[model samples]
Target chain A: GAGVSQSPSNKVTEKGKDVELRCDPISGHTALYWYRQRLGQGLEFLIYFQGNSAPDKSGLPSDRFSAERTGESVSTLTIQRTQQEDSAVYLCASSFGTGGTYEQYFGPGTRLTVT
Target chain B: SQQGEEDPQALSIQEGENATMNCSYKTSINNLQWYRQNSGRGLVHLILIRSNEREKHSGRLRVTLDTSKKSSSLLITASRAADTASYFCATRSISGGSNYKLTFGKGTLLTVNP
Candidate 1:
C-alpha cells in the first residue's frame, strides 16, 4: 500500500529553462491531478487526468504548462520557459475514481526555484 | 479566484484545548473536504462531509456542512502539539463536468502549544 510519490524533492533552474516534475500515483488509482502552491498561498489547479479520456487542461496557466499520463500510472508535468512567477511547489495527487466519494492522496511535492 | 475562504487565518491554542476553523464557499458543492498540511509538505486528508450531511465525526475531529449557508466548520477536540498545522477546506462543485478538480481555500494556520 504505497502512497503517491514525486521525484526531485527540490529543483533549481534558470529563467527560460524547461523543467519536468514527475509523479507516481498509488497503485490502482484511475485519476491524477497536478496543482501549484505559491508561498503562503492557496493551491491552484493545473491539470487532471481520468483514465485515458481527454485530460483537463483548463487550469493550466499558459500554453507552456503541459502534462501527460501514461494509462493510469505515472504523470509528468512540464513547464516551459520558466519565469520567477513559476517558482512554487508542484503537488501531485491521485484517487480511486474521478469524482466525489473518493479522497485524493497527495505527494510530498517538488519545490521548483526559478532563478 | 478561490472557491473557498477560511476565516481567522490563524489560531493558537494550548494543548488539550479545542480548536475550530471555518470555511465559506461561494458556489454549490457536492461535498467539502478538510485537509491538514504539516509545514509546507504534502497534505493529509482529514475528513470529507457530503452536502447532505450536517455533521460527521472521526476520532477527535468533527466536521459540519451547511449547504443552505454554503459553509462548513472543522472542530478538533483535545488538540495536542502534534496537531499544529495548516487546515484547508476544498470544495467539489456540484457540476460533474470538472472531473476531479477540488477548489481549495487559503487555509488556517493552527498552532498548538504544549
Candidate 2:
C-alpha cells in the first residue's frame, strides 16, 4: 500500500526451527532498517541497507541472524536455529534518504514466538 | 549495544496534566529522535533534535537535547488518555555515517488516567 508492509504479522515456531520475516518498504525509499524488540524492552538494531551499498550488519545479535535487501525494495530477515530468547516483535522501517534528518516510516511489525 | 537509557521505567499521570520523560545516552551523537508506540505496534516518529539544537517544539510536544550532559527530555503538555504509550529515544552515533543504525533506549511507559 502507501506505507511499509510486513508479512506474517504473527508467527509461532518451535525452538531450533528457522524463520524468515519479510518487509516491503515504501516505494522509492532508499534506506531500510531492521530491529528486534523483546517483551517490555526497547528496540535493538539489527541491520541497515542503503541503496546498493553493502548493508551495515554491525547490529545483528548473532551469526544466526541474517538479512538481505534486493534492489532497494523488499527485505528479509532470517533467524536460524531460533531460541526462546528470539521471541519478540521484529520491526522494519524505511526512510527517503540516508541523511540523518529524514524521518523513518515503520511497518506494523511481525511478532515471532519461539516455543 | 544500546545507546540510550530512559528514566522512570513507568509513569502514571492524570489527564490534562503534563508528562515528562528523560533519556540519557553514551558517546557523542549526530542527532536524537523520539518515537511513540501503542500496544506493541509500529512506532510513530514524534520529533528529532540535532546535537546543535538545544530545544524544539511541535504542537504540544516539546523536546530538549543537552549535548554536554548527553541527555534529552520529552514533554507532553496537556496530556490525554490517548497520549498514553511508550516513548523511546533513538540516537545516531557521530562516529558512524549519517545513515548509520539507530540505537534505542529501553523506553518509558506512560499511563494517562482520565
Candidate 3:
C-alpha cells in the first residue's frame, strides 16, 4: 500500500506458545528488515532481506527466531517456543536499498508480550 | 551489538528551546540517519547525512556528521511538544560483510514541555 504495514499491532501469547508477526512492505521496495525494541531501548536488527540476495540470517538471535519473505512482498517472523525475553515491540521496515542512501519506512509495529 | 551510543540518555526542555543529541559509533559508516518515535511505536525518518557530507537540514531538524571522529549530532530547533519523542541514530557500516545492516543506538528520550 502506501507504507509498510504490520499485522495485529499487539500480540499476547503464553510463554511456551509460538507467535508469528507479519509485514507487508511497500510495493517495489527491494529491501525489508525486522527489528525488535524492548522498553526504553533501541531497535535490534533481527533479519534482513534484500532483493534476490541470500537473506541475511546472521542477526537472528537464536534458532527459535526465524523469518521468511517471499520475493519482495510479505514477510513473517516467527518466534517458536517463546520466552519472557521475547516480549518487545517487533518492527518491520522497507527500503529501496539497505545502502546507497535509501531511508527505511517503518510500520506501526507489533507489541508482543509473552506471559 | 548496537554500534552507536546516544549521549544524555534523556533530555527535557521547554517548548521553543533547542534540543541537541549526540551519537558516537565504533566503526566507519557509509551514512548516518536520524529517526523519531512517538509513544514507542513506529519510527519516522528525520534526516540523513552521508559520509562525504557534513551537515543536512530538513525543516526544523538539522544533522551533522563527522566521519573522522565517528560521531554525529541532531539538532531540533524551536521544539514543540509534538516533537517530544525518542530520537535514534542508525548507521550503515562501511564494513564489507555487513554494509547492508543499519545498527541503531539506545536513543535519547526528548521531552519538550509546553
Candidate 4:
C-alpha cells in the first residue's frame, strides 16, 4: 500500500459488544502503532509494534484493550465488552523503522460509536 | 497523561495571515513533530525539529524548539483556507531505548476565513 490504511472507517456498536479494528501499513515499513483519541482530546498511545517485537505495552488503557501484529504487516486492535466511553476514533500509524527519529505516517482512522 | 499541551485551543484568522501554535511538554525529549488533521481524519505530518536543532522550515511552515524550556512552536506563514484544520504537536521521549512512540498534545483548531 502507498499509505497506511484502516478498515470500516466508521463503526457503531452496542454496549458490551466486541469490536475489531484493522490496519494495513505501508509496504516494507517495520514499525506499527495504535492510538485512541476522544472528542476534543489529545491522542492516547495504546500499543507499538516494531518488526515482531513490542517492548512497550504500558499504554493500553485497560484489560479490555488488546492488539496484535503479524510480522511487519497488518495489525489488529480488539476491544472486548466495549463501553459507552469507548466511543472515539482509533488511529493506526507506521514508520520506516522503530528508530527514535522516524516520522510516523497515519491511517484514516476508525471512528467507533458505542450506543 | 498527555506529554504535550498546545495553547490557544482555537483560533480564527483570515487567509494570508500567519497562524502560530505553541506546545509545552514535561520532561526531556529527543525530538518534536507537528501534524495537521482535517475533518477528524487521519493526521498528516508537517515538520519535525530535533533536540539538537533550534528551528526548521518547510515551505510555509516554520518550527522552533526550545529544549531548555521544554516547549515548541509552529508557525504557518501566509496561511490559506486549506490550512483550516487542527494542529497537534507530539514529542519523542528522551529515555533513549527504542522510544519510537510519540506522545501528542490536545491540539489547536485553526479556522482560516476566505
Best by TM-score: 1
TM-score: the better of candidates 1 and 4: 1
Q: Which TM-score does chain B of candidate 4 obtain?
A: 0.97
Give lDDT tens digits, candidate 4, residues A17-99: 99999999999999888999999988999888888665367889899999999999899999999999999999999999867
What CAPRI class is candidate 1? medium
Error of 4 at A8 (Å): 0.8
Interface RMSD of each: 1.0, 1.1, 1.0, 0.7
lDDT of 3: 0.93
* A-chain TM-score, model 1: 0.98
Candidate 4 CAPRI assessment class? high
Q: After superposition, how far is residue A8 of candidate 3 from its true place, in Å?
A: 1.0
Q: What is the DockQ of each candidate?
A: 0.80, 0.77, 0.82, 0.89
TM-score for each predicted model, relative to the true structure: 0.98, 0.97, 0.97, 0.97
Off by over 4 Å in 2: B96-99
Ranking under DockQ, best-scoring first? 4, 3, 1, 2
User: Looking at every candidate separately, what fraction of the true A–B Cα contacts under 8 Å does it contain?
Assistant: 0.73, 0.76, 0.80, 0.86
Clashing pairs in 1: none
Model 4 residue runs over 4 Å out of place are none
Give the CA lDDT, 0 to 100, for residue A105 in model 2. 90
- Model 3, A9-95: lDDT tens digits are 999999999999999999999999999999999999999999888999988989999999999899999999999999999999999
The positional error of residue A115 in candidate 4, measured at the CA in angstroms, is 0.4
lDDT by residue for model 2 (B25-109), tens: 9989889999999998799999999999999999999999999999999999999999999999999877746446688999999
